[model samples]
Target: MTTYFLDRGGRMTLPGNKFHLRVDGAGGRVAIDVTHRDHQGLSSGRRDRATVSRITQRTIIAAVPGDGAPVFRDGARVALFIESDDEHGSEPLTVEVVQQDVGATFRAELARLTPVGNRIELSVRAPDQLSPRALAAFRTAHELLGARTRPHAVADEIDIAIDTTASMAARLTDGSIPALADLIAGVSRAAGCDLRDVRLLGPLADSIAAEPLGTLADRVAAVVGETGVGIGRSTGVAESGNGDDVVLVVTDAPPVERLDTGPGVRHLVLSEEPIAADAPAQTGIVPAHLTATAVTAPTVPDQDAATLRHLVRGLLAALAARA
Candidate 1:
């Protein structure tokens, strides 16, 4: 058996012997292409055709016929195979099976790291072993064929808005608070942004004695324990009119009537259950556009946590890309 490594646009030819194949990658998924051609020259008039009879994760079976007569089965392994034979059987007849490796493992790893619901901006460095053209194709696939997300500038700052209300207690207890804190750190590092400059915002009312907004910001700071600006009482934050600012609001269902502002806030509702549609507006918070993202609490299933993490990461990525 002959083993061939495929580049972005490489091709392979197969001998008539039966063959076996195996593919390994991070996601364990690969794309396969198969084509067949006919050889010239024959002794009696004959038309040649090849048929792929079976396909699986690791194997392919095909039948190649000569002169449109009896069919001969050819077994092949690997992701894809091509079959063809010489009409006259004089040119050392054989079939060509091409295998191209698209770096599914690398793509899967990237996907794992990518957050769901967010735009992804990819910066791919060519592997030393691969050519520039191959890398370019890989990048094209990532940008065009894969999930779509906007790309952001590497050095841009991301403003994170938090919702500090009685509702946040659930997130704090459910583990979403810490998980979100870690996510923020990862995003800050990946985007080359200054986590120190990150802004935290929440709701505040003179009626609340404990200053839940301030306390929430402190909790977020303690969870991240990183230097960043904390702003409570939404109206108190300096209005810079900076389009670069990203407002991430963490909240539970609050009545819209309670909200006193809505110009620059985006909502991240954390709960084991979905937020109600008529949930009250967070008081004194104005979001330019309110985008609702969900984070899973401890009460959520493990699978849901994974799903929510992926989604939140994607959302953050998208927000970062916008910057």
Candidate 2:
């Protein structure tokens, strides 16, 4: 089976069909009604009866009934995201609202969000839009099984931060630095972003050029390879500013100094160390953090290399959604 994993607020393309619900978060009032899609009649599997909700954050899920739960399948794209309705204050988020009526309450609150929030919908099977988390879960599914008719789309304007510290010397021994650099460059290229939107910051390299993935990777390897690891203030990354909706941080050592990520900015982090529990997830949708500390692969020559693959795939999934 394809390994499925992702940050809390991750999103995936629904090739088949997903529920289209309407929620108005205006004046503390809420209403969520399932608006069927064209393929509803064809989705005869238990999957057709599934429900995935996004209380307040984004991560809208899609799946089918399986070992007591719904499994993900291709088709029907779901359109249930969150934005402020401006008239109200905020809304709720729930992945499963079927077992209870919490989804109804979530719909009411979602309807009241501010800044004229988008139409609210869901794909979950349970309730209590308010999970123990502030973010939703995307569980980034890997590549498509076959030809993709629709390209993956996510938030526009993204910012990526890579920490260049002495801790990265370990990666050199494992030949992971170059691999990581290549992944970073590839994501930007695949996103078809303006060269300027792709920002690179580290203890060694710094630039905003729209270079080819290979060239970018080479530059990263040279700078970081020569610089090695050390305890230094990554001022460049800190000052890069929060101009993008999504910011991805890739590093072995997170900056200990000043790094200002705007309040509205969504941050996704991939690290070699463990992340603190308090770091917000889904600052808008789902979990936005990953730790390679406990993750390993027996087949890979080195654990760091395997971890690099996971990080790359996860980042790619998020970037594709944002693109």
Candidate 3:
């Protein structure tokens, strides 16, 4: 009697072919279409008079179908497609059935489906595309801010403000800022969070707002010199709802003065330096190592402590002896 859970568009790989299970979501009113792989014809369940519980948020409870349960067996893989009332369709998420204990096998497999699971998958597939530091920063944020504050289905509307001050040129040149933005946007897509807009903060001027995240980096770089570090001013002017909105400011230097970024807005600062104590009590800083440049060598994955020590010693000695 092991239960499986999945949000909209979530994919899972499970064990076993012969199984009696109830698939449920959308208050048991959703269309459940199950297809077997390798030409195995699996029966699609019926909808008439099925006992369905209320669908709440992203949580899906199983619907008990009396004598209407579909039989799934003799297939190496099964594809489940669930469509809601709004007619939102997703590609079938295939579940590979392997010969193993269901409970034990699922426990190991489901551990990977953390809040930051998308970031983990991206790291494995394309490590070079983004910095490890950015990946680590976002993972930490998910733990501190996302996993705690955000709901599974209806997450808060998050806005991002990037510091484009003259001091940021080195980070801009190294592609650190761009990579950080990419990771933030990426995680939002992977995890069910809403990214409202990205703002470019410049000195003594208005913040430049951009959306559609596709051309964010190029757009920012084209006018990086014109932007300023008006942390206080930008924070003051940021339009946010009653604490339902989250403002994440990625900057090296945060203002010491208290900020008033509207009522009930949860503000967070990501930087290498600690935020000033005078800042608003609601504002907190999450330490992020964003100093890596584009030319920096990528850290080898799964290195033990000794290998890391050797690498660090070599880099330090080279730095100390540099001409």
Candidate 4:
């Protein structure tokens, strides 16, 4: 059987088979475009569009169609087959999913993919905000996509803020808070920032206020331990981000929508993960953004530096303009 498949399981496509893909935000899921085009003179016999299914040699005789005919979901396991003219026992043509390769997808989207230190660290806020089913999905995905990574180091006295609202710590493991705190501490050390200099603003004011920088091994631990309240109400942290050197916002997107930043506060938003849907952004707060392989990429596939840069570009530009 003549078959072609897109490696990486992250992207699926059919090239010579005439199935072009467009990853668009149609509903709330990643939408794939499947256009059927006729290539004249390629074959004398009529090209009938047969069912798309994955079949093993053992079960070739009685394989059922895999999924939806017209609309196919991303990362789905399926195949396309054109009925062969041969008098064989079963249809001979079988094709596999050709989604883009993970590396190819990254290379196309990123102008440059700098190596991030091994590990992808993320702390979820407002666990209460997500439903049980949604949280489970997030956990599965999170487990798959582990700690942040990059070989580089930072030593600047930049500050980071996390919104640890109700049950947000639930997103991570049992003792993740301490581990996350330690990771931030390592990052702060790389940036050469004292624990006190690395301000950590969060909803738990009482907890943070109770901890002192001297008591912690590093600035990250100090901030993570301390508690502060409100998005715009941090006592020392200016909403406009005035004196703050560098600010990173670790929270889900929506509630932080109206978050204020400073004139020069280059910001990094570690969102809880934008709604996982190809659907248009339904929230009035977030305008629709289409991520296609054709245009400049919205998020680099696997590159952290480029991806982070893309995420904060607009915010940084605006703040820089004011600065």
Candidate 5:
């Protein structure tokens, strides 16, 4: 397989079928033109059809068929366009042509790009908003989670807001909140965000606490109790973010007006209930126990913990999709 990386206005042509691809980068997207012409013998006429495909930084993979064929034939080429959102247009994607499925290959390549940092410091707010099971799970898996990575199109920073209301106390107690925090932080480093914070959005008030990832659970749990149940009134956080931030709010409560993060911030809600009408995107927090059958593994004895790890694997992918 041949791999090619194109900068702005770079062109490449396949040797056999005269499959030509021209790429242009600008404004956090890559624009590509694929042209195939018949140049053999009497068929030396230029097909001259200009097929343009625009790929945003969020989606780095796109394929254009050569010679209008389902499969690559002689003199036919397929183009895969990859681009990053950097200002200088750095990190151009690798385009390769192979006989197997390109989509599967792309997915495999993305999974290999882990985060840059292996350690993430712990920052928590309203420790009472966290739970025992979540805390335990986080502590057990903190190192593994902190070593994770995210996909392309990631923001510069990632912030997670956990709803500490009475209604969500059950979810918190089950270890979902802490698991979610680990999930986000694990991928933050790879997504180009070195800083990650978790804020406990309670009903009454908010507080700040910091510790190392391994011992954070004990600290968070001991501050309140064995559980995050009935912490207090449902209050929200007052964190300000800009366009370079990806703020993920984990809440079941629909409309907590005070939860307004800020304008120009890309917000994603991880909730089972319907969020505000203006919210850009929302993803449900799937109950791991209910889906235990789907999360089967021979080595993992702890089903809940295994399921939590499974969820962590998809956190960055989901964020990339929403982003």
Candidate 6:
């Protein structure tokens, strides 16, 4: 018999119409109605079910019944079947399974990072594992922000600050292009801004001619492909200057100096990985009298472009909300 392992948030895709519910080895069919009480006497919703499946070791056949297809929703409950090797007088074992919705969990994190009401600013810190998801949620929040500013004249422009250093070569080849492309798409869609308006700062600025904001996105992609230059080690700021409500900083490492802040410059930090716990304290050039918000995206998965896009969308939403 082959043993299958399922963790708290593990998932298994069902091929066709074989099964009605996804199953997990650990938690039996997850339900949506369960709530957990925390230390503060407050109850919060926790994972109801985990979704997963097992494939036969020898044949690689899915262990689900009925054509082996998936038939469950994001939070459906399921069952596990254990077949006995010995046919005669054998005892059968069955267990319950649950499905967990990763998308839902990601949205919840985004909600926590967003602030409510007019002109409120907030910062976010996301674990590297969740950065992509967090960024996608941020983009969603951006649309919501636009909705809030309907009466007031909101600016569609954003100033982007990127780090340029020699080490960026690896990130440029590996992940930065895709990540930036996703960001450009998300910003364009969420803020109703033309792609051409998105500008590249520094030496790269001269290499690519500034075109109509509508064409800026394509130009940026082309530049990324040709030069293969990644956001280097330098740190700069990206601001939607109209209201000074958002500032985005993309860097592989921490800033050498603290950011300068004004009424509207809400600080956000995006990194390829988490800052080391024992790193020395940041000093110098702190933005005077303005609170800063930071968000990080450390690892962009090599095999998951869709997830990466979703993450970028989230970041855009979050920034839009602030605007």
Model 5: worst 10 consecutive residues (lDDT sum) = 104-113
Residue lDDT tens for model 2, 70-95: 11233212223322222343332232
* Least accurate 10 contiguous residues by lDDT in model 3: 101-110
- Tell me the whole-model lDDT of each prediction, alpha carbons only: 0.32, 0.34, 0.35, 0.28, 0.37, 0.32
List the RMSD of every prediction in angstroms: 18.8, 16.1, 15.4, 19.9, 15.0, 19.2
TM-score of each: 0.33, 0.37, 0.42, 0.28, 0.41, 0.34
Give the Å shift of residue 215 in candidate 2: 2.9
Residue lDDT tens for model 6, 1-323: 33333333333322211112222322122222111111011112223222222212111111111221122222422333322222233332222222223221211111011113311111211222222433443344343432342222222334444444454455445445334544444443334332223334334542333233334435555665565454433223343444523434444444457543432332233343444544432111111101111224533334344444444444444344232
The number of the candidate with the highest TM-score is: 3
Sequence-dependent TM-score of model 6: 0.34
> In candidate 3, which residue ranges exceed 4 Å CA deviation?
1-155, 164-175, 203-215, 225-235, 263-288, 293-323
lDDT of candidate 4 over 1-323, digit per residue (tens): 56443222222222121211123221222222111111011111112232222211111111111221222232323222222222324434433323221110100110001112321111111102222222222222222222223211221234445445443344222333333333333333222233333344444443232123223323333444444234343444524343424444443342434434454243333333444443221111111111111112333344433332232233222122221
What would the per-residue lDDT of candidate 1 be over residues 121-177, giving only the tens digit for each residue? Answer: 111111123222222222322322223332233223344455444445544444454
Best prediction by lDDT: 5
Writing each residue's lDDT as its tens digit, candidate 5 over 57-142 gives 12112222223322222232233332222234333333432212222011111110111232111111111222333333323333
Off by over 4 Å in 1: 1-155, 197-234, 238-240, 258-264, 275-309, 317-323
Candidate 3: what lDDT?
Answer: 0.35
- The candidate 6 region of ten consecutive residues with least summed lDDT is 34-43
Going through the candidates in order, what is the number of backbone clashes in each? 36, 60, 4, 44, 9, 56
State candidate 2's TM-score: 0.37
